[model samples]
Every structure is written in structure tokens, then in C-alpha cells.
Target: MALASLAAASLPTAAAAVRSRVSLLRRAMAASPSSSSCAGLAGSPARVGVVQMTSVGDLDANYATCSRLTKEAASAGVKFLCFPEVFSFIGSKDGESIKIAEPLDGPIMQRYRSLAKESSMWLSLGGFQEKGPDDSHQYNTHVLIDDSGEIRSSYRKIHLFDVDVPGNMVYKESRFTTAGDTVVAVDSPFGRLGLTVCYDLRFPELYQCLRFKHQAQVLLVPSAFTKVTGEAHWEILLCARAIETQCYVIAAAQAGKHNEKRESYGDSIIIDPWGTVIARLPDRLSTGFAVADIDLSKVEAVRTKMPISEHRKFDSDWKTS
Candidate 1:
């Protein structure tokens, strides 16, 4: 069966597991707003910001770019701000990523945490090179920090980019990056956010689990996609996920050339549950952010009208025991 079709098919065990897990998450993250609580804000809209960046080998320079963007978003009254993958540093040479990998409690993350508190805004540090279990490998981790400078939740990118595109580029991310095993979702004032990195966008099953099982209303895809692939499939794939999950999708992207060998396709976008592009960066490779109002009522309205989750059927052959 096609992966897209498989995503629509029922996965009873996965659904149950996510339900049980999110229940525990609610108790743990007491600061997180509930869906019922967010209903009260239907009269008002929460503003979100997505940043498109061109991160290079200089760590300080990359941090400076992020800092500037954060200030801009905060000044604009953005409640939640998301940065692209490798927002901190995209190395110019091989093996540089692992050399600079740091733990969640390290100085690099501490600075970001402080930035969130100082700006008085929730931040999704879309992707960071996190120190993994082994010395030689790192995890491409996505971190969520609340306005109060607290770590809300983090998800390591599960799907690595290990493809040799016909004639464009050859990326073997798995060579130095350790794959994460778990799926993660978190609740916020905006809505429940389903966290995912670049390559994960290609897998719709993850989005399905987040929407149907974890009850995610917004999906985050932070990527540093190559120019070749982004031109062909980036927006198409992102819109498909939003349509399939019936959820809002926010994609923060890295744009322009990172180094001599690395270049990205930058088109940061905010999409509604109906697959409409609400906001996007005008200049593809410019370091900037696009802001949009995230209305949870829209999510509720769409799902209510369609009610596909309740109507999906399972093939008898694949039904769980």
C-alpha cells in the first residue's frame, strides 16, 4: 500500500499509546493550556511568527541573526516564534556538527532559554545539534521553550535525510546523527503542537498519529531543505500534511547558501487547516520572519465540518488483535 494510504488506515495500538501518553503529558506540563481553555480565546487570535534564516559556520553570527529576529517578532506582539532548522549553526566543513554538539543544559541552549524569557514569548528553537548518547554522534533536536524560560518539551528528529538525489545533492545525515525513537507532541496557548523536523514532512503517518491520536491542532516543520528539492516538493509536501491532518502547519526554513557546498531553498510559510497559505516570506533567501494569527476556532470548525477522524475505516487484514 502507498505510505499515504497507510497513514489514513487505522493504527489501533498507536492511537491508544498516544492517547495514554498525552494524558500523562497534560499532568506533567501543568502550564500547558487545554483545548477547552483555549476555546475561551476564540474571540481573540494568538499571533505566531515563523523565521527564515541563512545560518552558516559562525555560531555567534547565527545566534545574532536569531536574536535580532526574536526581538523583531516580540516587538510585533508575536506570542509564539519558531526558527528554522540549524538556526544556531550550520557548519562549513565536514565533522564540524558533531564537534559542536551540546547537551540540552549546555551554554548554547541556556542562551536560547534566556532569549525566550527576555523576549516574553514562547519559542520553538526548531532544530539544534544536541549531544547524543555517544561521543561521535549527535541528535537533530527540536526544542520548545515557554515564555517563562522553562523547557516545555523536545523531540529528536527521527527520520534522517539519507538520500542521493539524482544529480543535485547527496546527504547522509545518519552517518553522524543518531535517530530518535519516540514521537512527541506538546500543548500550548495556541494549540497542541505536533513537532517534526525536515525529512519527517515526507511521512504522513507521523502527522496522522499527531492529529487523530495526540490531538494536535498545529504542525511544525522546521527545515533546511536543499534548493533542488525545495523547489520541487517543499510547499507541496507541507500543504499535503496540513490537508491530511486537518491542522495548521507552520514551516520555518533556512534560505540561501550556507557555505560553499550547502545551499537551502527558503520559503517560510504559515498554512491554515484548510491548506491555505496565510503568510509567507517575500524574499526567499532573506533572513526574516512572517507573522500570522493562529485561531484555534478555525481548527475546530474544519474538523467539525469534516469529521473524517470518526469516519476512517480499517482494513480487516491489518486490524490489531
Candidate 2:
């Protein structure tokens, strides 16, 4: 459809965005009229912030950008802040990724830990290049830090994005990135939260296990999605997981062209249980974030109303017996 014709379709979406913003405002007001922090606001479970970034090969530059954004999130009373994948660095070539890979407790994490401590905000380092066993491949890891600057949980990118698209667009993540074997969930003030990285967003089963089996209230998907794929599948995939799991979906994304080789799509978003895109950052390439108030009550409300997990027909669970 032409741009004018598309307006009709966007009308409802515009209305929905308004509603989401209003809902967030009301929730924020209810918890604390003036404060945005969990400490400042007594009753709120937590106020979360999601960041969208244009990261490049320069590690110091990326860190500086992240630091500025982190300060902005803290100023807004964001108690929990999540950043896009490859927050530490996004190199020019595939091989350069392994070169910059660092250990979990390396300087990168230490600096992020300090940021978390300074802001008094729980930080989710969406995706980092953690040094693997050999130089051949590194692990795309997600590290979770508590407000006190302690590492809480870390999940490696389980499903690598290895695809050969038309127009000679080819990506072999497995070429330099090792895959993770286990699913991970962590406890937070808000509730149990499940963690996953970019390509893992493509698999619904991972989310199913996180919600139904692991009992997660929130699902995290930190991505550096390709522009083409992200434009086509980003929102749909996010809403699907939120609706099916009845959990809040928090996705932080990398935006803009990182180098000559790659460009990312970023409409960094946080969707509610009923598949409503409650909060979203700009679709254009830039650095920004969207904050949302997560109420565990809403999770219970949605699950109670839909009861999809309770009504499953077949068992997809593993039996040790």
C-alpha cells in the first residue's frame, strides 16, 4: 500500500500506542507520583527501561554511548535497565568479533557493574562476546547484574543465526559464535525472568519452556536484528511470545549501520500480556529507550483469562522416568 493508504492501518496502532503510554503513566503515577525508583516508590514492583543503540567497532565509543544512555535511564527513575545486544562492541568483520571477546569478569563487565552500582539500577547486558574455550568461536552471552553490582545470571545465545539470504546476504553466526545448551531464568524484584538473545527470538519453544516450565513472568530478548528480518518479523514475534506466554516481553535492540557489512532494525519495545505494544522507541536509527511499569498482577490477570498453558493438549515436557 502507498504511504497514504497505510495511514488507515496505522490509525489503530497509533491509538494503541497512546493507550499504552497512558496506561504506563497511570501505573507510574499510582506507584509514586514523583519518584521513578523502586526505592523512592514504595509499592511498584519495578520500573524497567530498554535501550536502543547504534554500536560500532570502537569499544570505548560504544561504552561512552551506553554510559550516557544509562545515565538518562537512571535520571528517569528506571530501576531496571536493559541494553541492546553487542553493547560492548560491534566489530566490522565476522572474525574481528572473536578478537574483541572478553571473559565474563573482564573489564567490560566490571565497568557495567560500576554503572549499575552508580545508578542503583539493575542492569541487563543484553549480549556480550564472552571468550570461549578456543579462538575459533566466542559465546554471545547475556549478563544480568543486580543493583548492588553483582552478577546474578548469564545466558548464552542458544540458537545461532546461520542463514544465506537472497541478494547474497549471508550470515554464519556459528562461524565465530558458539551456541549455548541450557535455558536460564533468574529471580528479580518484579518476578522470575527468562533470558534469551537475538536469534533465539525466532524459536517459540524456548519461550514456552521459559513461561510454562520455568515459571517466568517476564521474557527478555536482546537483539541486533538485521534490518530486513527485523522489519518483517520483529513486532509479530514479540507480540506472539507475549500473548502465548502471558508474560511481559522486553526487547532491547541495536539500531543503524554498525559497519559496511551490517545494518540493524531497532524499534526497541516492551509489550504487555495481551499483545499490546505498550512502549516503543523510534524505528529510526538512534540511541534512546522506552520505560514501562510491570505489574505482576497483569500477568495473573491475563493467564487467568486465557488459560492457554492450562489447556494444552499434548505434553512437550521431558520425563526422566
Candidate 3:
């Protein structure tokens, strides 16, 4: 489908009627805490908080920032929270990163687990450099921690960001990280969540499997996107994924200058099923968060109205199950 056509399809419908109904629903939800999640749908919407950060080599400082952000999100009544890729730490060099890589059961993760229990909230720990089995190549691993602080799912990033730009910057992630081979999804309060990391944003086939095969309702793209590419393609790609898959897309990002050599484009966003940008944040050094109400009804509504999944034609040769 043409991008313009999808944009036009999502324009306001019966504007006055929708405004009035939304106002009433908000009022009702504010009055009852227990019923807030399901105010406008059969199943309760998962209220999500996306945390944006600029993490460097200081593990303790990153933890403090995350601690403050997590506490604030918890107070705001969010059930689940997601942090940017490499939320744990982003070192100045690949050698430094390899030196600091930790196991899933390391002290850093233990601290995160404790924090999750303290806040009584579920957390997507985003991406961290995990020590590979052989201890030579690292894995860009993402972990999903439940409300009770149990590790529910872990996905190693499949796409290594190997890019080059003349007179700009060149990054060959495969030199330091081993690519993963699995398509992972986990069941959560929000819905079934399809997991992918920074460079995975460029590949649409992986997302298709998450939607069609795994029946994922939400997709998480935690990233440390370069400023150049992010400016050009970030929102466009994020919205396209949401529109094509008919799923909620939450992208927490590393924003601002992390070190002397690198900076990230940080327009962190949460997009809905119909490609509507619900919440967003500008690039900044300070830690910040934006919350979005995740209603599966909206996903179903778009799918029912468009029926694109049923209309797909080139399915026989498609891979990535």
C-alpha cells in the first residue's frame, strides 16, 4: 500500500463524536483505578512508559538515571516500562564494551531485577552486551522482566548494523557482536510482544513473522539509532511497521551525545496500529519518558477495516518463521 493512502485512511473519523466519547472515557477511567485499563475496550489496555536515555561508560550513573525514571513512571501508574537499547551501558569503544560485557545473571541485572521488584512493575530492559558462550563475540541481548521480577523472555538481536558513509561514519557491528537466529515473542499483560533491536528496524520480514506467525499484538524496537539515519528514516520506518503489521510499536531510544565519537538521533516515539504517533520525545541528555495507552481494540479495528493480512498475495516464498 502507498504511504499516502495509509495516512489518509487514518485521518479523524466523525471528529466531534470521537472527541466527546474520548472525553467521557477519560473521565470514567480517572474515577476508577481498577477499571482504567479497560475503559474503552473488552480487555484492559496496557499502559506503557517509554524511557529515553543517553548512556555512556558509567554503569552506576546509568543505573541512577534509570532508577529515577522508573520510579516516576511507577508513580504515574504505568504497568509496563521500556528503556532504550544499551540501557545498561554504551562504552566509547568495542574493546571497552567487550571488557564490560556481563552475563544475564550479573550484578547489573541483579540490580535491575531489584529495581523492578521495588517499583512493582514489568520492565523491558532493552539491549545489553551479553557475553557469548565462547566469550569471544558478544550478543546484543534484550530481556523482558515481569512484574514479579522474573525473567520472562530474552532475544538476541539478529541484524548487525554494518554501515558505511564516506566522510561520515562507518560501523561494523558484526566485528564485535554475533547475530542471533531466533524470532522471539513473549506473552505479557499488554499482549504478545514481538522483540527486535536497533538494526532490526530495516528488515520487514522479521516483523511479518511476529505478526502472522506469532500473533504478536505489540512490537518493541529499542534502539541507539545514528543521528543521520534517524533524522531521515526513523519515524517513517516505525510508522510503516505499525501500519503494515497492524500492531502497536514502542521504540525507546538513546538520545543526544553519548561520547566524543558518537551521537544518536532521539525522537523516541510510540506509534499505534493505524500508524498514528501517540507519544513522542525530542532528543535530550536528561532522562525522560512518555506514556501511551495500548488498546488492542484499536489494532482489531484497523485490521477489521483494512483486512490487509488476509489480502497478502506473495506468501509461498516468504520465509522467517
**Clash number for every model?**
0, 0, 0
Q: Please provide, for model 3 over 249-304, each residue's C-alpha lDDT reduced to its tens digit, 9 standing for 90 to 100.
A: 99989988889988887867799998998887643444688888888888888889
Each model's lDDT comes to 0.82, 0.78, 0.79
Q: How big is the positional error of residue 32 in model 1, measured in Å on the Cα after superposition?
A: 18
lDDT digits (tens) for residues 1-321 of candidate 1: 000000011112245545554444444344433242332235577889989988998889988888888888888888899999999999987789899999999999999999999999999987799998898899999999999989999999877777776556678888899977667788788888889999888767677767766778889999998887788888999999998888999999999998888999899999999999998877787788898988888888998999998888744447676
Task: State the TM-score for model 1.
Answer: 0.87
Cα error, candidate 3, residue 312 (Å): 1.6
Quote each prediction's TM-score.
0.87, 0.84, 0.84
Better candidate by TM-score, 1 or 2: 1
Give lDDT: candidate 2, residue 104.
86
What TM-score does candidate 2 get on C-alpha atoms? 0.84
Tens digits of per-residue lDDT, candidate 2, 52-170, equal 88899998898898788888887777888888899989888768878888898989789989988987889889889999979888999999999999999999887777776444367
Task: Give the better candidate number (2 or 3) by lDDT.
Answer: 3
Candidate 1 wrong stretches, greater than 4 Å: 1-43, 316-321
- lDDT, model 3, position 269: 76
